[model samples]
Target chain A: MHVPTPHTPLPRRPFDRSSFVLSATLAILAVLTIYGFTTFDTNGVDMDMALDMLGDNAKTLFFAPGLSNVTIEGLLKNLGVTVALGFLTTVLGAVIGMVFALASALNLAPVWLSVVVKAFTAVVRAIPTVLWVLIFAVSAGLGSVAAVLGMTFHSAGYLIKAYAESFEEVDAGSIEALKASGADWWQVVGQVFIPSSRAALMSWTFLRFEINFSTAIAMGAAAGAGGIGFDMFMASGFYLNLREMGAFTYAILIFAVLLEYVATKLHTKTMQG
Target chain B: MTILHVDNVRKTYGGNSYALDGVSFSVEKGEFVAIIGPSGAGKSTLLRCVNRLIFVTSGEVSVNGIAVTGLSNPSLRRLRRTIGMIFQHYNLVNRLTVLENVLHGRLGYKSTIAGTCGFYTASEKNRAYEILHAVGLHEHIYKRCDQLSGGQKQRVGIARALIQDPTLMLCDEPIASLDPSAAKIVMDTLRDINTRLGITVVANLHQVHVARDYATRIIGVNNGRVIYDGLPKDLTIDIIQKIYGSEAHDLILADGDTHGTH
Candidate 1:
């Protein structure tokens, strides 16, 4: 005699705190945006003239694209410089971040040391990368030095958090097994944690490299670090040449796509290995 | 000769509740002992205290005649190398090869730089191969641990522990997650290690019948205290009732023995 039990359903509440909060936040932002648009934003906007000029600029930027101020070789050389900047800062950040990450990982380091390292990295990460660059400009005199220092500092802060979390997420059971086998702290990290978290670490490092690449481009114009971004700045702002701006934009877009393809391939290979 | 001793071991969580309340036991060398209890009965805690993986709140634990409580960190690690531990989860590194994971057992004997560089000598590699062969995992030596089946993974775990050349082996629910057939193989392998290598084995087991079938001695626990400690044949229905309390009714022992009717 097999009998199925009757199902009794519980009453559902109409109110959900999380959804209500989200809706309320979006409503407030909508109201504030509407108020700003209606009140103070139209004084100097010149809607009709602005729309006409925007249409013209878009046409010239997209349809008639050719570099007049710089040769293809010069543009490529400048692009290489930007890439080198990104690579240098990424390597420096990875090395320095790894040390702090080890000190900050909960399972590996003392509680106090982990807390101190995490807090310091948190503060550094809170600051915008560009702001860090500007701050370093005061000391390093607005050249490649300032850009490299600022970018490395910010990248280290970002990667320290990423690397520490990956290390912390390594299976605790594996760590316990190693410890039971009499592995010391360094040995446990080397044998178990590093090997286990290698894929995550590599992915995070590549993600940071991508970020540093874009930052390097921005710093080229903003901090006088010579790269394609300096030439683009000249084409768009100083020279006001929309065609040259379009050409530079296309070059950057192609390179960005290639970088993504490479990163994806490397990630897949490492995961399989 | 006694190989492991737990003297009045007490473990408390958050200053109030006792996980293990003044538990005491001793095991002779080459004995296969299974500590059996329902979940939350301090079976795992007692096993951890033997190796000082988790410290005992009070009382002393001695392994091979050395007190485990007051040792410094380096000395504790030095003492740990002689002991091997296996977990219910088969805690081999999933991304690493079986050979690499087995060689991890030798990490305690190497310098930090050598270990970091993964400089295992040829003899160590040969020993790892032999252990893998013994565990029937030689065909999967180059396979990542994640690719192995549950039984194969547990065999890899056993091989890793054996490569330590340990005097005593501690297992925490070594088969709680396995299927019945896989569980049988793991238990059989553990019993073989006990008999063949003469390594003392202490395991926490949840299944009463499995414990009785494999272990030479059974120690039953309930509510943080040992209730029954004797030969498996001596664990009658009444003693099992005392050890398991109200839950004893659901248990069916091997050879058609159920609670209260035997």
Candidate 2:
């Protein structure tokens, strides 16, 4: 072994508090897991039959899936509806969120306003997207309108935090330069802040869009919002057609991959530009 | 004529101690005044105060014969349009193209709607291109600022400042971050601009010899106050000691030889 500092002894690391705590936690979890399985809670259960059914279900749902109950045209229309739901809510949320983000950023706004905006957005973010949708469902009556409003509300909360942090990460020198040039507040925001943080803003917005797309599908079934999620729910629950459910899942997966590809390309383009 | 004046300026960062204590100076038009000081000697603060970038705790900073303190937002902005500022870090928006960043100097003269929408007229663009060419950045105008070298970036900063058609330019440690070679280029460019364009230049500099070489007048600051203000030839060894304190020994030794022209 080639030791550069051969005269000096290699210092040995002392056992630290965090390592002890981590080991203790793992030991406790291991004991609890073993104890849980050894307690013999399987009473009157047929293991063989359960395992067989699991294998059969997996094979039926994934291996031999086909669209028997629904036509490709119907599936495509529902997919379009879901895509529209996500896109609309994301666009609306991003527009409004940018305003709030600028207000919340310390460099861009007054301290009092930034604090207030941050506190309000924090509360909004603490609530889950589904709960917000349900809350709006009470007023808007559990339709596409409620879904749109709820998703947009949650997305704005999420994006305000993301966008504000990105804006705050901008170089202080750049901000000072713009201010020194006698640029007004809006001028600084539009020219320097927006252009400087465009790539980050786009990256965050795309992440939110992906989240919204998935949530829109979930909202379709839960809130009776019309989309492909409702079709999946009907096929699985009312129709008990696992093959149709598989077809819908494949369609969603393809769309998601395409969305991600587009996002990555745009992100690179912005970063280069 | 006096193009810039600082009258009895005092600044404190919400503390009992002063960052700038009763400092005063005046600059004639077309003069290149270099302010040399140790770190934390409030050189940057004094430069910023002239533009009202950092408001002084108590002082009168007048530029182009207009008082800079206590003006309304609109009037303050109007006052700022006639003055340009350069920074040590260049401070060009990295993601923006060189042309776009240079044109930013016109933001002060534009309407809010026009500036926000980036609606620059043909003349404004032509002036930007002309300034870029003068700075030797015409070849890289369409390239993003982040792609440029430090020397190139600083030139872009100068072009941005010049496009304002400013009567005065404030440079805070303009070449402090550059190498010796690049520093020479920046200093030469500043001298040329002062002599040719007749714009008053006030720059905060860390190098004593550089100040002596380029400035028509040198202001030496120590402990947030002006200790020496005279022609560069009159800045004797005793004055350097008074301005730099114990740090003067190394400076005098290291600066014994003339700087390389390269």
Candidate 3:
């Protein structure tokens, strides 16, 4: 028996250094340009006035003995209202958004229906959440309902797009098998598409809830709903109390942490199963 | 006793090459026929056309003497209920239980409201159980589909087709994905069903020995057309060489060998 010798390796090409140098130089120049534009100062008088107000508010808060108790109570009440608004708006948005998403998914609906739904979602998302809140406040009057509707509209737009993408990612083979087995169109959607993507849909819904929570806070301030943002505005204008403002700010932070924890738990549990 | 008739069936995709080129054949009731051919030789397209899964470009397919090509969507769906199809991948809903997947075969018979509510009648449930038992999967009915082995999953697929109680069964490479032992089991099960229930069966298969073992009639396809149709014993080496051309020797196996070990 004869043994064969291994072949020698071919020469490797040298690395090109010019592309890296050019990319790094361009990135640094872009950063410098953005920094120079943003730092250009035109509001010196406005800055001075804001500093004066903050100093006065701090002085008052330091002198007040009962400030801590009042701030705590206010923070709790504001947090409760914010959570309630977020929950209500998210539920409404999810129901309507799921319908639109299903209608738009290519695997589920006709071509014309999918196109119409995509256009509708695009238009809805184009309007800012703050603008919706302002419009509702002006037309429907200042209240929690206006704030909730504004948040729901924006959330529905975002969720419809996300849910539709998720629905499209479902296995095409399962759907084809269902259709070939004499299943009706609706049957194919319910049994095949829904079950395959249930975990992904749940994760997307939880993610939307976190976004909607923050949106509710901002919309509440714009629409005069009784939430933490409203308390922050009132404390700034009427009492000028630094402790109250700090407490409300801290409350927003706490809410964000709680929502993050819940979302993480949900994602982990779903993946485990 | 003719159960299915295909008259000049032709299927052309993208207006260029034909998947099936003007092929015509009839299946008698209770007969077990196997379509053996090379890959992309129109075996699957011909099988799909029988159930109207893929629309025939220029032909008519009649099931139980009723014309299926000209039927509307609703009528076509109704016609499909009488025909059962099996796939190479098994195609069971992975997230659903084996029993529920089998029960899906009754979607054509169930009302829209009933299907939406996830309700199946008592007799239908019993029939599903009976079919599962017949396929030797009764003990695994409540298990999720992904939990089963390859052979077991294919058995569940067969059970699902059986629950339809179809007049004709169309199987597209039903045993191509299994090991030798498992493939033998599935083939034997199909043969047993054909003998007992007397339901007409048309299967697409790649193995010549498998076709000879289970099928009474064998049809050879090459380049989108049927080149041979006769008894299994009459399919000599010369005809095999013509059908497969360059790789004809690979198609031959020992006669009456079921386990694929010979």
Best by TM-score: 2
In terms of lDDT, which candidate is stronger, 1 or 3?
1
Q: After superposing the true interface residues, what Cα RMSD does each candidate give?
A: 0.8, 0.9, 1.5
Candidate 3 deviant stretches above 4 angstroms = A1-26, A29-74, A135-138, A141-143, B247-249, B253-262
Q: Model 2: residues >4 Å from true position, as ranges? A: A1-23, B256-262
Provide the interface RMSD of candidate 1 in angstroms, 1 decimal place.
0.8
Q: State how far residue B28 of model 1 sits from its true place (Å).
A: 1.1
Report the C-alpha lDDT of model 1 over B187-260, residue by residue, as the tens digit: 99999999999999999987788788889999999989999989999989898888878777677443233222
How high is the CA lDDT of each candidate model? 0.90, 0.90, 0.82
Query: Residue by residue across B1-262, what tens digits does model 3's lDDT show?
Result: 8899989888998868999888888889989999988888899889888888788999898999989888887777777878888888888888888998998888877777676555888898899999998899989989989999999998888887778878888889988888888898998889988999888899998888888878999999988888899999999988887777775665554334432322
DockQ versus reference, model 2: 0.77
Q: How does chain A of candidate 1 score by TM-score against the true chain A?
A: 0.92
| Candidate with more favorable, higher TM-score: 1 or 3 | 1
lDDT per residue as tens, model 2, A1-273: 975776888789997999999999999999999999899677788878989998998888888778977899999999999999999999999999998998999998899999999999999999999999999999999989899999999999999999999999998888788777778999888888888898999999999999999999999999989899999989988999988888899999999999999998998898777
Reproduced native contacts, each prediction: 0.75, 0.67, 0.38
What's model 2's lDDT at B191?
94
Please compute DockQ, using alpha carbons, for every candidate against the native two-chain complex: 0.74, 0.77, 0.52
> Chain B TM-score of model 1, please?
0.95
Report lDDT (Cα) of residue B198, candidate 2: 94
